[model samples]
Target: MRFAHLRVEGQTTPRLAVVEGESAIFLDEVMRRAPRDLQDLIEQGPEGLARVRSAVGAAEPGTSVGAAEPARGAVDPVASDPAAPGTLPRHPVADLRHSSAVLRPAQVIAIGANYAAHASELKLRSETAMTIFSLWPNSLTAHGATTTWPEDLTTQVDYEAELGVIIGRPARGVHARDALDYVWGYTVVNDITARDIQFSEAQWSRCKSFDGFTPTGPVVVTADEIPDPQELWLTTNLDGSIMQDASTSEMVRSVAEIISLLSRSATIPPGTLISTGSPGGAGYSRKPPVFLRDGSTVTVSIGGIGSLTTHCRVI
Candidate 1:
C-alpha cells in the first residue's frame, strides 16, 4: 500500500493516510488505534502494517473517524468532507498539502558517487571506497513545496534524482544477501545541491543540506510492492525537459550492498532514509551548465514508486 503524510489545505498539522487511486483515506477515520505517522507505524513493525491493512480493508463508506472531533479545524469526514468522490469520504490528493515522506527518521544517510557515470562527470575519484554522508534534517521538505535559498549562498543549484530506501529494522553486520529484508519502503528523492560549495568544501552535508533542499515523496511504496529495487528506473525533469535518465541497475553497488556495508560499522535504525545516489546527465556536466533559478519546477520519478516535484526560489 502507498502512504503519505498529508493535510487539508487549511490545516496546519499533517495526518497519515493511505493513497488509493486519486483519493486519500485518512487512517484516523477508519481505525481505532491508527499509527500517528509513518515513523510511528514503522516502529510497530510488520504487525502494525498488517493491522492498518485490515482496518482500511474493513472500513465502510461514510463512517465517522475513530478519533474525537478531528483535531480542531481538521477534516470531519462525517460532517464535512469537501471532496468525497465515492460512497466513502475520501479527499482528493490535489486538495491536500504534503509533508516530507519520512519524518523523525533515525538518520538520513546518503551515498555519493555510487554511480560510475555520475562520478566520472563530477571527476570524483572515490570508486575505491564508498562515499557516504549525512543529510541534515532541516533539508527535508515536501513534494509540491517550494525550496528557497539565498542567491549569495548558491548560484549553481543542481538537482540529483535518487531512489530513497527506508530502513525497517535495526540492521548491523548484515550481509548483502539479507540486506533488503530490512527495507520498510521506497520513495523518490530530489537531492538538490549547491555545486559551488560542494566543490570547495571537503564534506557534502552543508552544501546539500540547506533547508528545503531535499524534497521527497508524494508517497512511499511498501517493500512488498517493489520486489527488485535494482530493476527500477529514475529520471529528472527540469521545467519541461528530461535531463537525468538512467536505471538503478547502473549503480556501481546495488541497494542491498549499500545497506550491508553501512550496517557493518553502525546499527542502521528504523526509518533511516538512504538516498542511493543519482545517475549521469547532471546539469553541471552540460556544456552550458543549467541550474535551478527562481520559478523553476523540478520533478524526479522512480518507477514502481512515484514522482516527486519541488518548486524552486532564490532569495
Candidate 2:
C-alpha cells in the first residue's frame, strides 16, 4: 500500500494517511488508535501495520467525514465510533494537503558517488568505499510545495534525483542478503543541492541542507510491492528536457550494500531515510549549465514508485 502525510488546507498539523489512487484514506480514521505519522507507524512494526491494513479495508467504501460535511470539526480517522467500536472516519483525498511522506526520521543518510557514471561525470571517486553523507531535517519538504532559497546565498542550485529507502527495523551488522528485509518502504526523492556551496565546502551536508532542498514523497510504497530495488529505472526532467536517466542496477554499491555498511558502524534505527544517490547527468555537468531558476519545475520519477515534482523559486 502507498502512504503519505496529509493535512487539510487550513490545518497546520499533518496526519498519516494511505494513498489509494487519487483518494487518501486517513489511517487514524480507521484504526482504534493510529500511529501519528509515517515514522510512528514504522516503529510499530508489522503487527501495527496489519491492524492498519485491516481498518483501512473496512473503511474503504465509506464517505469521509471531511467529504460528507466540510464544516464538521476534524475527526481522528482512526477514532472508533462511540456507539460502535469498529467504525472509522473517512475523508476525501482532495480535501487534504500533503506533507513530507516520512517526517522526523532519526536522521537522513545519503549515498554519494554510488553510481559509476554519476561519479565519473562529477569527477567524484567511485573506486573507493561508498561515499556517504547526511541531509539535515531542515531540507525536508513535501510534494507540490514551493521550495525557495535566497538568491544571494546560492546562484547554482541544482537537482539530484534519487531513490529514498525507509528503514523499518533497527539494524546493526546486517548482511547484504538480509538488508532488504529490514526495509519498510520506498519513495522518490529529489536531493537538491547548491553546486557553488558544495564545491566551496569540504563536507557536503551544509550545502544540501537548505530548507526545502530534499523534497520526498508524493507517497511511499510498501517494501513488499517492490521486489527488486536495484532493477528500477530513474529519470529527472528539468522543465521539459530529460536531464538524467539511468537504472539503479548501475550503482557501484547496491542499496543492500549501503545499508549493510551503514549498519556495521551505526545502528540504523527505524524510520531512517537513506537516499540512494543519483545517476549521471547533473545540471553542472551539462555543456551549458542548467540551474533551477525562478518558476522552474523539476520532476523525479522511479519506475515502480511514482513521479515527485517540485516548483522552485529564488527569492
* Clash count list over all predictions: 1, 7
Clashing pairs in 1: 29-65
For model 1, residues 1-315, the per-residue Cα lDDT tens digits are: 999998876677788889877777787765556777999999999989987776566545554333222443233244222223332346677777899988888899999998989999999865688999999999999999999999987899999999999999999999999999999999999999999999999999999999999999989999999999999999899999999999999999999999999999999999999999999989999989999999999999999988999999999
Worst 10 residues of 2 by lDDT: 77-86
Q: Residues 1-315, candidate 2, lDDT per residue (tens digit)?
A: 999998877777888888877777776555557789998889889978887777666654454455543332344343543213334555666677889987999899999988888788789999898888999999999988899999999999999989999999999999999999999999999999999999999999988999999999989999999999999999999999999899999988998999999999989999999999999999988889889999999999999889888999999
**How does each model score on TM-score?**
0.92, 0.92
Off by over 4 Å in 1: 59-88
State which candidate has the highest TM-score.
2
For residue 65, model 1's alpha carbon misses the true position, in angstroms, by 12
Backbone clash tally (model 2)? 7
**True-structure lDDT of candidate 2:** 0.87
